[model samples]
Target: MHLADILALRPVPAAALLMAITRRCPLTCAHCSTSSLLSSEEHPAEWFSGFVETIEPEDRPELIMLTGGEPMLRPRLVSSIASAARSLGTRTMVLTGGFFAPRVPPALDDVAHVSVSLDVFHQREVPRENVFRLVHVLAERGVAVSFHVVGSGPDDPYLTEVIETIRREFRDGVPILVGRVRAAGRARAWATADERVSSDRPRPCTMAAWPTVSADGTIAACCNQDVLDHRPIPGHLRLGHVSSDSWRSIRTRCRTSPLLRAIRTGGPQWASGRSDGGYCGTCRLLGTEQEAPASPAIAYLEQQVIHAQLSAGPAGFMRRYGEARFADLVMLGR
Candidate 1:
């Protein structure tokens, strides 16, 4: 699958699954989101394999995105999940730090897409040329490739230089998804807070649409790092555990939860009817706030919002969720 194809489905509820297969990474980039270390916590392989095995061909997500502190560390698990997901008609994608570059992993054979991380922090551990080489090989093998690049911000000189180089080296064959580093994970200690003005407007939250499987196998309604790492996940955002919940069950909850539906259609500020917290802060506070009851109005609004987002396409989705300055880059290899 192409990068645009995967991102185009990003707004649809339960259309995709983001699974953090492991939290152990060899490269300790300074801005590492998961704060992964060689001894970082990673669950037993069965926790992941067992959950994937439960996916029935008739009721499965269109895509399964495998990620981690470094998902490539578990080559066998990556191959196993890709094979199983593909057999069920579900495309699989992997996001890696490219530590094993210069030698592509045999497991990626079953993967339809691979997105490698490229940035200043990552370059400290994994060479940019090695990542480029890995993408080159993957592209030659007919596997779709893209770059998940991060920089200080849209105007950061590093982003400009690297983007230009990537466009030149790949001749725009490899799409790039550029984003600003957030104050999360290991970067929390030093990364500056986002300065975007918080608004009480009814802004829809697309992040709440997909179910994210955290490192410990706890499934969350959103991909927020705090939700993934914190204990006692807010009642509203916590989905059933992978150890017990099947894909169908999780999808049902994600799609049917009244609060989640409202969040998707009108955002947390609108759903909770309070704007004390920021966008995500308001979402995290939903557990304490009342849950929006299922209603025809909410259902209708959800569909309308989904339709509008679908009309916006991949670059549009990036414009809202990613850095707008470079949103068109997602269309480079389309």
Candidate 2:
């Protein structure tokens, strides 16, 4: 699948699954989101394989996104999971820090897309030259590829220079997803706090549309790093464990939960009528009050909201979730 195809499904519930297959990474980037290390905890390959085996062709997601401290670290496991998902008509995507450069892993040969993480922090560990070489190799091999770049903000000089460099190197033949550095994982110590949402306005969370499988095999309603890292996930955001929950069960809860619907359509501020602790903090505090079954009118309104977002298309979604300045770059190579 291409980058535009993936972003176009951002607002649809359960359109895809984000699986963090491992937490062990070779490099120690300062902004590592999962706080991955050489010795980070990783469950047996069976845990991931068994869960993927449950994906039926009729009930599978459109895509399966594999991530980790470094997903490429476990090439065999990545290939197995991708093969299983592909067998059920689900395409696979892998996001990595690109520790193995100038040598694409054989396991990724069948992956639909590969996104490499590139930033000033990552350059200290993996040279820019190596990352470029790897991307060229993948593109030459007929695999769709892109870059996931993080910067201080839209005006960061490094962000500008790097985008220019990539466009020059690839002649705008590759796409990029640019985002602001978030205060999660190791970056929490230094990354700036996210801009607070105005309590007076609604800010629907698009991230909640897809289910994310944490490194430990617990699935969450959204990809919030904090929620995934904490033990005993907040009652509202917790989906279920991969070890015990089937894809059908997780997708059903994600799609049918009234509270999750509220979060996606109207945001936590709308659900509670008052922001308790920022946007996501108040989300964690929402309870049965927001779990009322959706009336016919409410359900219709929810559908309208989803359709509206979908109509805006991928670039529009990027403008809302990613850096607005470079949002159009997501569709560059499409």
Candidate 3:
């Protein structure tokens, strides 16, 4: 699958799954999201394999995205999961830091797509030339590839230079997903916080649609770095542990949860009606608050909202959650 195809499915509930296969990475970029290192914690391959085995063909996610400090660190496990997911009609994608650039691992042979993280910070560790070489190899091998670039903001000169470079180098054959660096993970200490949602309007969270599996085996409702890293995940956001929970169980909770539905359709501020804090802060508080039962009217309205977003398509999603200037790049080489 291509980047456009993946982003188009972003607003659909339970359409995809994200697995953080390992926390160990060779690179030590200053703005690392997971605060990963060569000695970071990592779970056994069996835990991940067992979870994939439970994905029944009839009720499985459309895609399974493998990520990590660097998922390529465990090539065999990546291949195994991709093979398993493909058997059930589910495609797989892997996002890596490209530490092993210029050398495509056999593990990624079965993956539908591969996303490489490239930015000023990442370049400090993995040379830009090496990443370009790797991307060329993957594309030559027929593996759909893209770059996940982050910058200080829309006007960052680094973003401008790198984007132009990628376009020139690939001749627009490769696409990119551009985003602003958020105040999360290692960047939390220095990066500026993202803009907060207005209390006056609903700002739905598109990221909540995909269930994320953390390194510790806990499955969270969303991919918030804090939610994944912190202990005692809020009850409302905690789906279940992969060690015990089945795919059916997780999907049911993701699709049926009233809080999640409210957040997805109306955003955390809209759902909670308290704008004293940030967007995710309000979301974290949702578990403690008492939520009324969803009425038929509310359900109908939410469905309408979902349909509208679905019709708006991937570019719309990128306009909201990604760097708007580069949103159309997602459809490049489609």
Find the candidate with the highest lDDT and give its number: 1
Candidate 2's TM-score reads: 0.97
Ranking by lDDT: 1, 3, 2
Q: In model 3, which runs have C-alpha deviations exceeding 4 angstroms?
A: none
* Candidate 2 residue spans exceeding 4 A from truth: 288-290
lDDT of 1: 0.90
* Model 1 clash tally, residue pairs: 0
In the order shown, the candidates' Cα RMSDs to the true structure are 1.0, 1.3, 1.1
* Each prediction's TM-score versus the true structure: 0.98, 0.97, 0.97
lDDT string for model 1 (1-334, tens) is 9999999998899999999999999988989889999899889989998999999988799999999988989999999999899889999999999998868989987899999999999898888898899999999999999999998878999999999999999999889999989899899998887733566677888999999999999999999897888998999999988899999899999999999999999888888887778878888888786878889989899999999999999999998878899998988877
Question: What is the Cα-based lDDT of residue 100 in candidate 3?
Answer: 88
lDDT of each: 0.90, 0.89, 0.90
Shift of residue 277 alpha carbon in model 2, Å: 1.9
The CA root-mean-square deviation of candidate 3, after full C-alpha superposition on the true structure, stands at 1.1
lDDT of 3 by residue, 1-334 (tens): 8999998888888999999999999999889889999999999988888998999989999999999988989999999999999999999999999988878888877999999999999999889999999999999999999999999999999999999999999999998999999888889999998866558488888878889999989999999998898989998899998899998999999988888888888888888887776788888888788674666665676788888888887788888888999889888888
State which candidate has the highest TM-score. 1
Please identify which of the two predictions, 2 or 3, would achieve the higher lDDT against the true structure.
Answer: 3
* Best-to-worst ranking by TM-score: 1, 3, 2
